[model samples]
Target: MEVDELDFLASSTLYRRKDFLETDEAAKSHPNRNYYYRKNADVDRLIEACTTKLKNNNDNTRALFIRASSYVKKGQLEEAIADYSKLLLVTPDDIDALYQRGTTYEKVGNVDSAIADFTTVLQLNPNHVKAAYARGACQNLKGDFIEAIEDYTVALERDSQRSVSSPKFHARKKDLQSAQAYGGNTSGVPQDAAKDNLGTVERGMSGLSLERQDSMLGQAGSSAAELRDSNGHFAAGSSAAEPRDITGTSASAPGASDPQGAEFYHARGFAHRKRNDYRAAIQDYTRAIELDPKHFKALFNRGFSHDKIGEYELAIKDYTQSLEVDPRNGYAFYNRGITHDRKGDYHKAVDDFSRAIEIDPKNADFYHNRGFSHRKKGNFSLAVSDYTTAIQLNPSHCRAYYNRAFSYDRMQKYHEAVADYTKALEIEPDNATAFHNRGSLYERIGRLQEALSDFGKAIELDPRSALSFNARGLLLERLGRIDEAASDFNRALSLEPNSATFLRNRGLCHRNRGSYQEAVRDFGQVLAQSPKDFATLSNRGYAHRKLGNYSEAIHDYGMAINLSPDSVRLYNNRGYCHAKLGRYADAIGDYSKVLELDPNNIHAHHNRGISSDKMGEFERAIKDFTAVLKLDPYNANAYFNRGSAYDSLGDFDKAILDYTRALDLDMAQGGDGSSQNAKQM
Candidate 1:
C-alpha cells in the first residue's frame, strides 16, 4: 500500500459527463438549458479489481494490506484486523502491520488487545515512535496512568532529539541569532522546565474546567481524526533514521527545509503541555503561531496553560484570538468567560457565557457557569432560573443545586434553600460547603438539633473549616453548652485569628457565662479593628455595665449611638446607663427619643416613667405608667409603679386602689403577691 494508491482508495474513482438531446426544435426552444448524461464504471468495480488482484495472488502483502486498509476505511474493523493478521503471518516481524492492527483494535475499543500489539511492536523495534505513542494512548484509555506517562516520556525524548539534530533546526537557530544580534551565546541558554502544579484541584469558583482524571497524553499530538485517511483508513507510518509524519501523509512530512513549520512546533508544544512544563509549552505555541497565525488549537491550549498559572488576562487574550480565528468555538467563549469571572468582571462574564449558551444550547456547563456569574452579580432570581435549567439538563449536577441553594439563601427563602442543599448532598454526600450552608439555614429556621448535626457533619468532612467551627460554637452557646462552645470558639479563633464575627460570637458566649471581663476583651478587640462597629460597641457597653463601670459603659453607649442614631436598642441601652448614673434628665431625654422612633415601645414608656418619678415629676410618671398598663393590661409592675407615684403625691386613696388592682393581677397569675415597690410603699 503506497501513499498514492491509499489516497486513491480514500477518494472517488468514477467519472461522469452530461448527455445532451439532439432534437433541433427542442434545443432551440430551451436555449438556456442542456439535457445530457454520461457515466464511467461503477466505484464497486474498483473494489472488484482489488479483489481480483488478491484472488490472483493471495500471498501478495501489498494487496492484503490495501484490502485491509479499505475495510478499515469502510468501518469494518473485524475484517481489517483479520486481513492485517493474515498479512502479519506471512511477514511475522512487520512493524507497519502490527501498528495498523493495533490501531484497528483501538478503533473497535479493544484497548487491551491494541496495547498488546503495540507492546509487541516495541519489543521488535524499541525506538518505534508510532507504536510507543499508540500504546500510551491505549494505556491511558485503560486508566493505566503511570504506564501511559512512561511511554509519552519516551516519545517526547525521541521527538526532542530529532528536532534538535535536524539541519533545518541549526539553520533556523542561526537565522534567529542573526536577527536578534545575540552573537554566539545561544549555545547553552538554559530554559527551565515549568513545575507541574496542573495536578492541583481547581476551586472552580468561576466554573473553569478542572483537571481531567486521565493522564495528559490525550492533549498531545494529532487526534484520531487527523491520523485517519479520508476514507477512514488508519495508515500507521514507520520512521526512518529521520522521523516521518505519524499520519503517513507526505503533505505533513517533517524535513530540514521546514524547521519552523506549525505542525512540528504544535506536536512539540503538545508534548511539553502534557509534562506540565507550561512555560516551555507556551514558547512552542508562540513559535507555532508565528509560523501559522490562525492555528486555533495552539492558541486555545496556550490560553489553557496561561489559565493554569493564574494569568487570567493573558488567557483571555489567547482565547479571544482563537475565537477570532474560529468564531464557532463555544469552548473558547466558555473559557474566556471563566477568566472574566475570575477577574471579577462579572458583567463581561455574563455576556460571554450568554454567547456560549447561544452557540451550544444543549451544554449544561454553559447554563451552570452563567448561573454562577448571575449569582456573583446578586441577580438571585436569574441565577436560580439558569441553575434550574442546568439541573434539568443534568440531574446529577451537584454544583448547580449547591449554587441555587445559595441564591435561595440570599433571597431568604430558607425552606427552598434547605431543599436544594439537601439535593446537592444527595448527589455529593461529602460536600462540606453544602453541609455548612444547610446548617446555617437550619439554625435560621430554629431547627437547633438539626443545625448542630449538619455543623458536626460539615466539620467532620472539612476539619480545617474555621467558619464551620464558629457556627457550631454559636449554636452550642445558644443550647447552654458554654464550656463546649468556648472550646469550639477557641479552635475557630486559632484557625482565623482575625474574624470579627467569630470574636463577637465568642464574646456573647462569655457574657452569657458571666465572664464579663473576658467578654469585654473580645468585644474590645473587634471594636479596635472596626471602630465604628455599633454592634460590638454596644456589646462592650453591656459588658462594662455588668462590671458596674457606669462611666465607661455610658461612653461606649454614646459612641454606639453616634454610629447608629436610628437604633432603638442603642437609645434604650443609653437610657439605662444614664439612669444607673442618676442622670435622670439625660435618661428621660434618651427614652423620649426611643418613644419618638417607636411610639408604642412598652419598655421605653416604663423606663421614662421611672426617670420622671426619680425627678419628682409624679404627674408625668403616672401618665407614662398608665400608658404601659393600657398597652399590657396585666402589667403588675406598671400598676405598682403608678401606685407609688400617686402615694408620693399624697393621693393615698387612688394609690390604694392601684395597689389593690396590682395585687389582683398578680394573684390571677398564681403569684405570691411579691411586689417589691408596692411593699416598700
Candidate 2:
C-alpha cells in the first residue's frame, strides 16, 4: 500500500488513494504491516467508533480522514461515500475528504459534483496533479475541450516530474480527430498512419479516467472520423471519402447482388432514419430489399420509418415483406404491432404483440405494450399479468408499475394502485407525471401528507411541467392553502400559455382562492379555446353566480344547454340559475327537461316540485315530492316540501302527518329527537 504498490490500484482512478495513503501512513507511524490484514468487520467497527467520536467532539474532520479508504479500495463505494459525506459535513474544507469524494463522485456519475470537489481541492493545493488531471478528464468527456486543455496544461506546468502528456495527449488528439470528422473533414493520412495512431488512441482511453461515458472509447469513439446524415448519405463533402469496396470486402454472393453492398444500404437507411429523413431512408432500405429481397433489417427499418412518418399502409407493406422473408423476426413483429396500435386496430395489435412476446419472452417492452393493448380492450386481469411479467424481467421498469397502477385504480384496488405507484416513483424520482398520478391516488386514500410530498417533489423536479403544477394546486386548495394554490395555478398557466384544460383548472383554483376577476379571465380563455365545452361553460356559470352576476350566470347556463341539450347536469344547473332570477316557469321547464333525460332522478323531481309550487301548482308539486319520498324515504327536504304542498292544498291532517315524517328523518340524521314534526321534516 506504499506509493510504489499504489500503482496496482492507480490504473486510472485516484479515488482509491485515500486507502493507499492510509495504509502507508499507518505502516510508517505504527511500524506494523500486520494490522492491514485485520478482519473486515473489525475494521468497520473501528471506523464506526471513530465516526461517533468525530460527531460528538466536533473533532478534526481531516485527521485520519482516509480511514474509510480500505472499504473504498475493496470497491465498496456506498460505504466510502457515507463516511466521506459524514466527514465532509463536519469539515467542509478537508483536503483528503474532497479528493476521495471527488473520485467517488465521478465513479457514481456525479461528474458535476466531482468537478466541483476536485476544483476545491486544487484551490487548497494547486499542485495536486491527480485532481487536476481528473477534473480535466471529466471536462473532456463532457465536451468542454478548452477547459480540459487549460486544466491539463496547468497540471503539466505544476509538476514536470509527472507526465500528463503521454496518455492525456492521445485523448486530446482523438478529440481533435473527432471534431474534424464531424465537420466533414478527415485526417487524410495514409491508411497505415490512421491504423498506427488507432492503437495509441484506443490504448490511451483505457489509461484515462472516464466518469459518465464509461463505454465511450471502445466502440463509440473508434468511429470518430465516420460521418453520415440521417438519409444514410455520407456527410455533405465526405461522400467520396470512403475506400472503394474490394472483392474481399465481405462474403461474396454467387448471385449478381452484393451482400455487403445490401448491408450498407440497410445501415445507411437506419442512419437516415436517425436524421429524420424518412423518405430518403425508406428509399435506401428499399434498395437493400431489391438487392436482397430477404433482407429483414432493411424491410424492418423501412416499415419503422414509414410508421414514424404516419404512413401506416406503407409500414404494413414493409412489415409484411419482413415477415415473409423472416417470419420469426420479433423486432419486425413488435414494430408491426406498434403500427396496428397507432391505427386503432386493437385486435391486430394484440395479435402482433403476442407473437413478438412468444418469439422473445425476455423482451420487457413486448409484455408492457401487450399489457397496454389488453388494458385498452378492458381486459384488466390480462393486463395485470403482462405488466407483472414485465416487472419481473425488469424490476426497475417504472412504466410497467405506472400502467399496472392504472389497472388497479380502474378495478378499485386503491391500496394496490398506491403500492405500484410508490415503486414507480422510487425508480424514477424525476418523473413528474408519475408523481402527479401517485399524488391523486394518495388523495383518494386520504393520505394527504404523502400525496403533498410527492406533488412537491414533482414540482421541484419540473417547474415547467403544467400537469404537476395543476395537481399540486388542487391539493393546496383542498388543504386551505388558497394563496399557494392560486400561485401554483398561475405557474401552470404561465408554463402551458394557452391550454384550455390548464385555463379551466386554474379558473377553479382562482375561484376557490376568492380571486373572482382572475377566475373569470381563466374561464374566458377556456371559452376561447373550446366555446361549446359544456363543463367549462357550466362551471364558469357557477363562478358567475358566486360573484352576484345573475344575468351573466344565466347566459352561461343557456349557452351550456345549447351545446349539450341532453346533459341533465347542465339542465339542473341552468334551472338553479333561473330559480335564482325569479323565473319560476323557466326553472320548472329545465328541471322537467332533466326529468325527461333521467326519469327516476330524485333531485330533479324535488327541484321541479319546488319550482312548480313557486308557480302556484301545488297539486303538481305534491305529486313530484311524493314521488321523491317514495324513491328516498329518508329525504328531509322532500318531506318538508310535500308537507307544505299538502297544507297549500287545504289538507291539514295530511300536512301534519308529512311534517311529522320530515321531523323524524331530520332527527335520525342528527342523532337527536325533538318535536316529532320538526324531527321528521
Candidate 3:
C-alpha cells in the first residue's frame, strides 16, 4: 500500500464529523464546543478508522500501531496493550510496538510486565537509550535501586558514545546518582517532584523535561513525511533516534555541536539535589553556569543546592544572578528569602519574600515564609498579618494557622492564639508540635485541664518527642500530680538525658514532694552541666537545707548569692544555713544585707533577731524583733523573741507584757498557749 492510499483511507474514515453529528444527536448538540468532547471525538474517529483498516487486512501493523496510539490517548490502557500485542505478534521484532506496550504497561502499574518488554527492547537494540531510561525508571519505582543504577549508567554510557546529548542523558545520570544515594532503597525522594523543603514552591527536579511522549510515532524531529518511504508509504522497520514530544510536534534534536548544554548540566544537578548530594549538585550546577552564565533554571537550582549545604552566601549570589536573568521568577525570590532567613538576615528575607509576593501574589508559601521572617525579626503583628493572608490564600494551610497562633501568643493575644491553634489542629490533627505549642499556651492562660489534654495528645501522637513529655511534666507538676509529673520528666530525661531544663523541673518536683536527697542529686546534675546556673544553685541549697546538710546548703547559697548579688531570698537562705551551722556572726551579717536590700523582709528581721540574741546582743536583737513586729503586727514569733531580748536586758515589766501578748496571739492562732520561745531558724 502506498502512503497516498493510507492517507486516503484515514481522511475518508477518520474525522467524519458531519456524518457522525447528523446521526448522533449528542454530537450535534455539542458540536465541538467543549475541548474534552472534541478530543474524545477525534480519538474515537481515529480508532474507528484503524479498526476498519485492520478488518480488511488483519496483519496490517500500521493500523494496529495507530489504533494502539489512539487507545493510549483515550486512556484505554488494556485496549492499547491488546493492540500493541497484536502488532508485535504480526512483526515479532518491532521495537516501536514493544516500547509502546511497555509504556502502556507502566501506565497501568504493571511494572514487572513493563520491565520485561523494555528488557526485550534492549536485547533487540542494545543502543536504545529510551528503553534503558524507561527500564531504569521502572526499576527505581520498584525499589530495585541497584538494577536502576545499572540501567541509568548504561543509558549514560550510550549517550556519551553518541556524541549528541539528549535531556534523558542528563536525566539518566540524575537517576543513577539518586539510586546510588538511596543505596538500594527509595527513601528521601520528594513525594511530589515539584515541591522541595519550602513545601508549596517548585524547586528541585521541576525543570527536567521528562514527560512520556504517547502521540508521536518516531523520534523527535521525525515528521510524518520522514516516517514514510520514497513511495510515501509507512516505513515499518524504521528505528527511532530519540524520544519525541507528546504533542505530535518535532522539537530540534540536540546536535553534537551543542552536546553539553546548560539545560543538560542543570538536569543532572537537579537529580543530584533530589538525592541530597548537594556538593555534587553544586559542582554540576556551577559547570552549567560557566557554560551559560544567564541560564535562569541552572542559577536558581544551584542556589537551592547551595542553600541545602549551608552555603548561604553562595546561594544568595546564585539567586541574585537568576533574578538578573528573570526578575519575575517567584521561586527564585522565595528560595532566596528562605536562605536569608536561615542566615539570620530577616530583613533581607522579608524583602525577598515581598518581591516574590509582588511577582506571584497568590502564592501562600511566599506569604507564609515572609511571616516566618517577620516573626524571627520580632515583628509579631506583621507576622500575623502575613500568616492571615497566607491562610486566606490557602484555607487548608495548617502551617500558616499554626504560625499565626505562635505570633498571636507572642503578642499576648491568648484567645486568638488558641483559636488559630484549634483551626490548625482541625486541618492536621496529628501535628504534635502544634499540640505541644497549644498546650503551652493553654497552661499560660490558666486553662490547666485543656493544657493537660493537649500535652497528652501531643505525647500520644509523637511519643519520641522529648519536648512533649517535658511540657506535660511541667503542667502535671503545676496541677499537683507530682507522681505523674515525675514519670513524664523521667521519660523526657530518658529521651534527652543531658537536658538541664528537664533535670531542673524534676528536681523542683522532688523538692516539693520532700525527696530532699533526690532533689539534691537532680539539681547537682543540672549544676554539673551548667555550673554557673544561679537558679539551680539556689534550688540545691534549699534541698540541702531540707536534708540537714547545713554546710553544703551554705556553700550553694553563697554561690547563688554571688551570681545574683541583689537576691534577697538567696541572702536570707544563706543566713538561715549560717544560724543552723552556729555561725551566728555570719548569719547576722547575711540577715543585715537582706534588710538593706529589702527593709520590710519579715524573715530577715525575725531570723536576725534570733542570730543577735544567740550572740548575746540583747538591745540589737530587740530592735530587729521590733522591726519584724512593725512589718507584721500579729507576728507571735516576733513578740516572743522581743520578750527574750528584754528578759536578757533585765527589763522585767516589758518582758512580762510582751510574753503575755505573745501567748494571747498564739492562742488566737490556735497554737498551744505555752510560754515557750518561737522555733529557731
Candidate 4:
C-alpha cells in the first residue's frame, strides 16, 4: 500500500529588533526599528525603507538583513540571495547571514550553494548545531545518506552537550538514526520528496500501509514564506538563542528555554515519522505535547504514528485529542477514520469519513477510503457510489477506479467491472495487479483470447507475479494447450512453491496429458498440506484408477466420500475401482449407492449390471440392464448385455431377438461391428 504523509507546517523565522541593536551602532540609532518589529507591517514598505537606508549608507548591514528577509517573505528568492551576498561583503564572517543565505539558496533549489553556505558556517563555528542540522538536511536531499548521518550525529552530539534530555537532542538523535536506516540509499524515501526543493528538511517516510495514501509529509499547502521559514531557526529573542533543558525551565536555572519550544519538537517528530521510525517519532510528539498540551500538530502526528504501529485505540485517542485542539481539521478526522478501518470498525470509519467530508468536501481520499470501508462491510453499492464520487473528484485517482471495479465484480456486474479496470489501467498502465484482476474478469466472462492476452501482459509487467502465471496456466489448460500450461504452472510453483492452487492446476494438467504417476505426486503434495481436501483426494483417486491401482483408487475414493457423503461421482469412481479388482459384490454395492443418490445415472446402472452378471445373478443382471436401456434407449451395449443374461437363463429366442435388435441399432448409428461386440462396464 502506498501512503501519503500530511504536510507539517512549521512556524516562520522572524528577526527581532534586538538582533540589529546588539550587532551594529548604526542599527541602535535607527528610528525605524520599532516599525520593523510591528506585526502585519506592510512588507513592501519595509523593503522601501531598507532601500532608502542603503542609499544613504550602502554598507548598512541592518538594511541588508531587513531587505533580504523582506525579499524572502515576498517570494523573491533571487533578490533575497543578492541582499544576503551584500551583507556577506560587509561582514564576511557573519554566521547568521551565512546560515540565512544558505536557507535562501535551498528555497531556490540551489542545493549545492546551500550546502556550501552551511559548510562555511560550520567551518566558522564548529559548535553551530543549527548549521550542522541544516547541512545534514541538504545532504539528505542530495542523496548523500552517509554524509547526512555524520552531520546529524554532529548536531546530536553538540545538542546533547548543551542539554542531554532536550527535545532538540532527541530530534537530532532520531534524525541520525533515520539517516543510518537509509543505509546510504534512498529506496524508502518517496521520489517526489527528493525532487521537491521546498521540503528539503521534511522528507516523508515511506512504507506506510495502503490506508495512508496521500498521508506522507509534504510541502503542498505551504506558501514560499512558510517554506523559507521552515528552513531557518525560530524567531530571534525566542527560546532558540538560549537552549532549554527537559524541565522547560530557563537556561540560567537548571533548565533553559528551548529555541523553537514545542514547535521544534513537532518538526522533529515529522522528520522521525518521515524516516518510518514511528516509536521514535511518538516520543518526540509526546514531548511536544508535554511542552504545549494544545499543540494540535503534535497530537495529530502522534496519532498518525500510533496508527502506523497498529495501536488503533491509541491512534483514535490522539486524533480525538488533536480534533479537540482544532475542531475543524479534516485531516484529523480522515486519519481517525483510517484507524477505525484498521480496527475493522466500518461504522465508525464511515462516520469519521463523513465528518471529514463535511469539513472539506473536495478531498478525494476521504471518499476513496470511505468506499473501501463500505466494500469491507459488504455494501457493494455504497462502495461503488463512494468510489465513483472519488473518481469524479480526482479524474486521475487510479485506486478509486480499481477499487470500484472490485465492487462491480462482487456485484457480478462483469461489464462494469471490466470498464472500470480498463480506466484504471489507462491511469496506471504499469499496474500489474490491475492487469491480473482484469484478466481474471475476462476469464470469468469467457473472453478467452482477451484473458490470455491480459494475463501475458501482467506477467510481462511483473515477472515475479505467481498469480498471473497460475491464472494463465489455468486458461491455457482450458484451451487444451497442455504443454504451455504445464510450463506456466511450473513457473508459478517455482515462485510460490507451496501454493495449493498452483499444485492442483499442474496436477490436473499432468492427468490430462496421461502422466498419471506425476499427477498422483502433485496431488499427494497438495493433500500433505491439506489432508482433508476433497478435490485433491477425488483427483488422486482418478489418477490411481488410471494406473490400475484399483485398491489404492478405492481407498482414495472412500476418503473423498467420507468428506463429501452425497458425492455421486465419488461413489461411481469407487465402483469402477471395485469392478477392476474383481470385487463384484462390492462393486454392485457402490454402484447401488450411486443409483440411490442419482437414480437416472446410466453409468451406475450399466456397471451394476456387469457386476451382477459377474456374480452369476442372471435375473438381477437382466433387470439392471433393462434399467440402463430405460434411461438410454439407444444403448447398444445394454441390449447385448441383457441378451447375454437371457441366454444364461436359457431364453434363447428372446436372447437372439435382443442381439439382432442391438446389431440393427448399432448399424443405424454408423457404428462398426467391433463397437457392437464390445461390452463396456
Candidate 5:
C-alpha cells in the first residue's frame, strides 16, 4: 500500500476491510477494482474480469453455455433460449444442449415444443432420464396419460436416484402418478361419478372401473401426430402448447417444470387432497401460496385442516386471511362462524352467520346454526325468525321446525307451537318430543283423553322417556288415581337421575301417597339446586309440619319467607307451620306480611285471625275476620272468629249478633253450604 493510502486507511474509519477499500487509493488498483471485491480480497471482478478475458479471444461452446446459463439466471429467458437453440443447431446431438433447451422450453410453458426437444434428446440418447421426466409432464398436460405414465416409468427405471435431485424431480413424478390415477387432462374427469386422482388407471367409481391405457408407444413418437392442428404447426409447437399472448412473441414462465399459464402446484395440491394425503397436499398448497399468495382456496383448505385438528385459533386466522383476499366468500364466513361457535362466542358466530347468509341466503344450514346460537343466548324471538327462514329455504328441514316449536312453546303461543311440532312429527314419524309437547298443551287445555293418547304415543316412541312418564304421573294424581301416580313417578325417577324438577314433581306424588319422608328428600334436592326456591321450601316445610317436626318446619318456613316474602301461598304455609310450633306471634307476623303483599288472601286472613285471638289481640282478630268476610261474605269461620273476638272484647251484643249471623249463613246453605262455607273460611 502507498504511504498516503496507508495513512488514510489508518485515519479514515477502518471498521473492517471495507473502511480501507472505499479509499481513493483502493479505487486506483484496477479498472474493475470494486470496493465490494476489495473488501473480500478477491482479485477478480466478475463481469469486468470476464470482459478482460474476452479482450484476448473467445468463441468456446462451454463459454456460450455458461453465458446462456447466466442469462437464464438473470430472467432473460428469450436470450437464453436463443443461445441454447444456436448451440444445439451446431452440435445437433449434444445431450447438454438438448437437455438445456428441452428444460428451457418446458419453462416457457411450450410443453409441446419441450416434448419435441426432449424427444430428440432421448432419440440420440434413449436412456435420458431427465428427458423422460420432462416428456412425461408435457404428455400429461396434453391429455396423454398413457404416454406420460410410460415416460415417468422410464425416468424412474433409468435413474432411481436423480443426479440433479430438485423439487421439480419429485413434483413431476407425483403429478405423473396423479395423472395416471385420474385422466391425463383435468376436463377428462366425470363429475357425474367419483373422479380419479391423476388419470392413469381408474378404480371403481359409480360402479364402473375404467380400463387402463397402454403405458408406452411404438417408434412413431407424438410429433408425427402433432402437425395437423388448426394452428398448422406441430402439436408440441402449437399455440395451445405455448402461451400465445396478444403480443407476437410467446410469454414464458421462468420457473422450470411448471406450465406457462397454469398453476401446476395448485393442481397437484388438489390432487394430493383428493388422494387423502394431507401432508403432501399441504406442501403443494404452500408452494402454490409462495407462487401466488392470494390463493384463497389453498388458504381455506389449510385452515379447514386446522379446524379438524382442534387448532381453532389458527383456523380462524387462516379463514380471516382468506377473507382478506376474497371478501365475499360465504364459505370462508361460514367456516369462521363454525370456529367462533366452537369457541362459545355466540355473538360472533351469529354475526358471521349473518354475513354468510347475506352472501348466500340459500344455505339453510347457516340459518339453522345461527338460530341455535340465538337460542343459547336467550333471544328466542330472533331464534324463531332464523329457524323459520331455515324452514322456508328447506321445508324438509326437521330440526328447524322442532327448534322453532321450542321457541314458540317458550313464548306461550300454544296453537302456533302445536303446528310447528306437528310439522316436525310429519317429517319424522317417530318424534317423541313432538308428541310429549303436544300432550302437555292438551293437558293444559282440559282435554284429558287427548292428552293421554299423545302421552301414550310418546311413550311408544321412546319407552324410557322420563318427561312422558312424569307428565302421566301428574295427570293420574290430578284424576284421583294416587296408586297409579306413584308407579309412574317411580318409573320416571328410574329414567332420570339428579333432575331437580323431576325430583320435586315426584315428591308431590309421594306427598299424595303419604310418603312424607321421601317427599321431603326430593324437595331438599330441588332446594339444593335453587337455594331460594320458595315453592319447594314451602312444600318441604309443610311435610316437616305434617311429621310433627315443628321447629324444623319453622326453620324451613323462615327460609321460604326470606326467598319470597311476597308469596301469599308461601306465607300462609309458613304461618301454618309456625302455628303448629305454638309460636302464635310468629304465625301472626308471617300472615300479616302475606296479607300486606296480597290484601285479599283468604287463608292469610283466616289464619292470622285465629293466631290473633289466641294471643288475646281481640281487635286484630276482629279486623282479620272482617277482611276474610269481604273476600267471601258467606265464610262460616270468619263469622265464628268475629263472634269469638267480640265475646273476648266484652261486647256481648256484637258477639250474639255474630253468632246469629254465622248460624244463619251455615243453615241457609242446607249443610252442604256449611261444609263449603267452612272450606271457604
Candidate 6:
C-alpha cells in the first residue's frame, strides 16, 4: 500500500512545492472552511516526503519513524503501529521508539502491549518519568494498584521538585488512599486474576490524601499557605521555622497562630495513617484539634484514628466534638454509630445511624450500617427494611445484599435469605462468604445438592477459609460421607487449632461412627477450651455412658445440670446413668425431678417405677406403675411391674389379675407370652 501511494505521488505534480504548499486559489475563494487549506497542504507534503523516502529505500528507519509519528497525530494508530514495528525491527534498542510505540498502543486501547512497551522503555532508562506514569496507568486499569503505586512512587521520587503540581503525584496519592482503605494485598497475585476480596477487608481506613485533600477542607488564602513539609517535619505557609514536636506542644507549633496550621497537622496525620501508624496519626490530629478547637476536619480525622486503634471511647469523644463544631456532619454521626456498634451498644448505634441517615439520606452506607445495628438488636424486620433501602439506593451493593440475607436467615425466611445471598454472589462472583452462607441456607431448606455445590465453590475460591471447610464437613456428615467429613474437620482443626465448634462437630462424627473413645477425647478437648459448655458436657457424658463408665457419665451429667438446672433432658440422662451404676435412690431422685418439671412425662414416670421396684418400695412402685398405665393403656411393662409389686406385697389376687392383663398386652404386641415374671405370678 505504501509503495503504490508513493509511486502515484512521484508521478503526479501534486508533490511539487508550488502545487502542494500553496492553497488552490479557487478553493480559497469559498467560505465556511473549518480548517486552513495551507495546513492540509503541509500535512500532504510531510506524508509525501516520508512515503517517497521509504519507497526509494525500504529500510529507511528515519522515514518510517516520521510517517508513524504523522499517523499517530492523524489518529491512524494501526498504521502508526506498523511503521513503529518496522522501525523497531531495525533498531530494537531504541528507547524513543519503544516509548512512542507504547503511547500509540495506549491510544489504540491495547493496554497490555502498551504496558509491555512502557516496561521495555523503563528497562532501557529507569528514570523515564513518562514510561513510569504510563505503566502505572495501565496497572491501575488492571486493578493492580499496589504495583501502580510503586511505579508512581518511583516517578515521584525521581522528580520531587515537580511533585506538587504534577498529576502523577495526585494520582499516586489517590491510589494509595484507596489501597490502604481496602488493605492492599502485597502477595503478588496475577494482575488479571479474579478478585475474591471485594469489600471483604476493613472499611473506613482511608481518611485523607496528603496532597489532594483541599476539597474536603477548603484551602488557605494563598498558595504559600498550603501545607508544606521539610524533611519529616510538617508545617503550613512559608515559615522556615523549625517544626514543633508532636510529643510536646509549644506556642510555635505547626498549628500555632496559623489558620491553615491545623490543615498541616491533618495532612501529616493522613501520612501517618497511610503507614498504619494510628497512634502517631492520633497525636498529630489531637495537636491539630488543640490548635483550632472548632476544626471539624481535624476532630473527625482524630476520631477515625482512634477508632483504628480500638479506642472506642476516645473515638466517640472526638466525633462528638466534631459534630459540635459542625452540626451538619453526617459522616461524624455515621462513624460514631460504627464505634457504638463495635462497643455492643446497639441502641445508641441505632440512634446515631438514624441521625446520620436523616442528615445524609442518600448514602447507602448509612442505611446499611443502621440495618446492621438493627440485626444486632434482633429486630429482623427493621433490618430488612434498611437493607432494602440500601439496595434501592445502590443496586450493586453486594455487602448490603449479604447482610440482608443474614437478617432473613435469622427470621427463618430461608427462601428470602437464599435469594439475597444469590443476588450478592451475582454482584460479586468471588465472594467466598456469600457462597459459604448461601450453602448453609440451601442446607437449611433441604437443597442438599445445591448446598454441596456452593460449599465446593466457596472452598475453591478461598482455600484457607476454615469456616467453609467446617460447614462443608457438617453437610457431608449429614449425607453419610463420614470419611470425607472427618477429613474436612481435620483440615479445619489444622487451620484453627482451638476452634471448639470444629472439635464438637468432629466429636459428634466420632459418636455417630460408634467410636466412643475417640468421641470422648474430642469432647474432652472442647471442654478444655470452654469448661462450662453445657452441650459438650452432655455429649461427653453420653460417650462415657456408651462405654459403661457410669460414674464418669453421672459426673458429667451432674455438671451439665448445674449449668442448666431446668433441663429435663439432662435430668433424664443423669437418671439413666445412675440406674446403670445400681444407684437406684439417686436415679429415682433424678426421675422425680424430671416428673416435677414435666407433669405429663411418661418416660419419667416409667423410669421412676423401675427405680422404685429396684429399691424395694412396693407401694411407690405400684403408684408409679398405675400412673404409667393411666397415661399409656397399652404399656405392658407397666402392668408387669405393678403385678411384681403386688406379689412382693403378698396381694396374690391383685397380682394374678395384673398378670392376666400383662399377658394379654404382651400377646397383642407380638411378644410371646412366656415371661419369667408372669410365670412366677
Q: Cα RMSD (Å) per model?
A: 15.0, 21.7, 16.3, 13.9, 22.4, 17.2
* lDDT tens digits by residue: candidate 4, 132-190: 76676676556565675566557657765866687866765564332222111111222
Candidate 5 achieves a global lDDT of 0.62
Q: 272, model 4: CA deviation in Å?
A: 2.9
How much lDDT does each candidate structure score? 0.68, 0.63, 0.70, 0.70, 0.62, 0.68
Per-residue lDDT tens digits for candidate 1, residues 1-681, read 343563354343322212324422333444455542221223344345457767777776766676676565555678878888988989988776787777778767788888888899889978665566667656655646467656655755654556677896576456433312211111111111111111232232222321221111111122322211110111101100010011101111222013335644554555566566778778867987898888766677778778667798898899899889878767677778777776789898889889989998986767877887787787989989998999999898776787787778778898998999899789878867678778877887989899899989988998887767877887887788999999898988899889776787788789889999999999988888888877778889999988998788989999988988898988888788888888989999999999999999998899899989999999999999999988999888888899999999999999998988989998988889876462110
Decide which is better by lDDT, 2 or 4. 4
Q: What ranges in model 5 sit over 4 Å off?
A: 1-314, 324-329, 341-362, 366-395, 404-417, 437-451, 471-485, 512-514, 592-609, 612-635, 638-665, 669-681
The better candidate by lDDT, 2 or 3, is: 3
TM-score of 5: 0.52
Lowest summed-lDDT stretch of 10 residues in model 3?
Answer: 241-250
Pitting candidate 1 against candidate 6, the one with the higher lDDT is 1
The candidate that wins on lDDT is 4
lDDT at position 627, candidate 2? 89
Per-residue lDDT over 550-614 for candidate 6, one digit per residue giving the tens place of the 0 to 100 score:
89999999999999999999898889888877798999999999998998788888888878888
Model 2, C-alpha of 346: deviation from truth (Å)? 2.5
- Candidate 4 has its poorest 10 consecutive residues by lDDT at 236-245
Candidate 3 C-alpha lDDT tens digits along 1-681: 443554444332334456556555544665555311223335577678778778788888877876776676666779889988998888989877887778778777788998999999899989776677667667655656567556655766776786436676566566433222211111112222222222222221010011110111111122322211111111101110010101100001121012255544554454455555778778867887898888666677777667656788998898888779877667677777777777888899889889989988997767877887788787989989998998999998776787778678768898998898899889878766667777777777888899889888978987987767877887777778899999988998999899777788888889999999999999999889888888789999999998999999999998988889999989998899899889999999999999899998989989998999998999999998898888899988889889988999999999999999999999999999988765564
Ranking by lDDT: 4, 3, 1, 6, 2, 5
Per-residue lDDT of 1-681 in model 5, one digit per residue for the tens? 232432232122323333554564554555453333232222122223333333454433443454455455455567667767766766777776666666566656777877888899799977666567567666756656567656655765665555446785676566434322211111222221111121232211000001111111011112311211110110000000000000001111122223321234444444444444557656756776787787665676656555545677987887898789778776577667766766778799789879979998997766866786687577889989988998999898776776677677667786787788788789877866667767776776677777778877988888987767767777778778888877877887798777665687778778767899989899888888888877778889888878887787788888877876566777677678777667899888888888788888888888888888888989998998898889899977688778888988999999888878887887886654332222212
How many clashing residue pairs are found in candidate 6? 0
